[model samples]
Target: MQINTIYTRSVIQTMAGKAIRDLRSGGERELRNVAELCKGCSASPGYQTFWSLLENILRRPDQQYAALLSRAANDVDINCLKTLIANLGLHAYPNGSQPLPGTRESGTSPSYWMEPLDDIMDPRMLHQQISRLQKQGTSSFLFRAGQKPELETILNIAGKHRQCVFFLICGAESCCRAYLEEMTALGNVIPLMEYETLAPTAASLKQAGILFGLHRRYCEIESLQAEENLLRQCIALGCFLGVYEGSAQCPSQNWELACYSRLQEMRCNGAQEIFLADLWRDREAVQKLLEQRSGQV
Candidate 1:
């Protein structure tokens, strides 16, 4: 007989035992033993192994099954995978079982992107712009122009509101330096600087304390050299940043923003605004947050 067929028959027998016990009394121990056996059974291949096993033992309704599914989903590192396991049973689950895409499964849902800033070009412009944008019910903004003074001003404004700034750091080193200066001047807006570069590794990124993400086709040696230089500066300045590898086909801007949100949530308590002084001086705060969410088992 096929292994799957034999397993299926064993599952059926276990379910039958559970059902029969439910109709009578004093069979709790027997049901428990059967549940342990099922859990010990190796999970099947593919994404739906746990789901199948859970359905096969539905009569027992083990809490361990739910816990296992959650852990397994996180292990896969695919957001959709978590949703699939959570919504559908472990095997041959039907579609439309999970929550809609773009919604976070764990932490609080992030705020939507606020109005885009056209006039503001630098972090200095953040103060006034953030106030004005807040009045309009916006939380985040992207400034494309590389104006240092303007960026600084904006960062200051956003600092008061605890808002975060996502600065696109493309172009020359001088331009990137100017952007960083403005961020320092604002002393507030949680700075999430995304540079267009090739090298995307944890060690390479740690130097900047700045979040890093790769640009499409940035794997060339020249691009990698520039990125390394930028990362060194980021580390020296004690910036809070991460590395993301981009793609020509997907671009990854939206996905990168999602990662930024996760990081911001780790640092801040969903506050709409943040301050640089608090961010830097709050060593205890940073330690606690990092320790709690080290993402390690």
Candidate 2:
């Protein structure tokens, strides 16, 4: 069944790619009718939304950030998205839906830092740790490392665990062009780099077909226009998502909610792919959103 689903998705993506090429060449065909595509593809809302989004972007070329959305439609890996829908969709609902028995508490085991010398630095130990997480029904993880070589080793290990998704918290220097290419090919390990540090290299990195998100600290907005400008710049540079880190500077609950609201606004306006994940403050809401998108009750 999995093989058949994969094959169906491959065909769908091929058709989308052809449509993109034809649209570029002044052909009249446009991407539409996602419900038709979903006939035998899958019942998952995530898959349906994915196709609908592609259709909307291609059909309305005059919308805001159309060029960036077009580039994303071309560069983003459909296989990776399918993997997320299949694996994280299962992980999102823990009512006996996970493939493995519980080995740790849900939600807490998904993110990690480079502590525990053996688990992250040693390849064998890292593999063992990931295997344990997999057994614990943890399908996604966020990892941080101190050095470039350590980051490389982590990506290598993550590629071996293709069933799971990994997020690497990286600095600008750590995410070079070659590293971006490696991550792109892996189709699972996503890098979340500090926005200020990566802005200069965003265009070059985008050209390399790298899939990544920018990490920014949330604070009281001094100028809403400036914030929108930054978002437009990020999207124009081909960023598919945003990872907003909660800051102690913004202590008011109202302020935090406001920040999330702004992200939600951006998501609804034109950049549906711009995901804001605040692991420190609102993990539950994030999980619920994932579960909802995955079509799990």
| Model 1: per-residue Cα lDDT over 25-114, one tens digit each | 424454445345444442323223433443444344432332222222222223222222221121221121111122245664422233
Best TM-score among the predictions, by candidate number: 2
Estimate candidate 2's alpha-carbon lDDT, on a 0 to 1 scale: 0.58
RMSD of each: 20.7, 6.0
Listed in order, each prediction's TM-score against the native is 0.28, 0.66
| Deviation in Å, model 1, residue 170 alpha carbon | 4.0
Clashing pairs in 2: none
Candidate 1 accuracy as TM-score = 0.28
TM-score of 2: 0.66
- Per-residue C-alpha lDDT of model 2 across residues 1-297, encoded as one tens digit per residue: 255434544455454455445434442243233223432343445445655665565465544434444455567665544444344433322232333332245544432211122345788887888777665445677777668878878888878887667777778765677877777677677777777766787766666656678777767345557766776677767787777767666556676678777776665455443554565555554443444433443
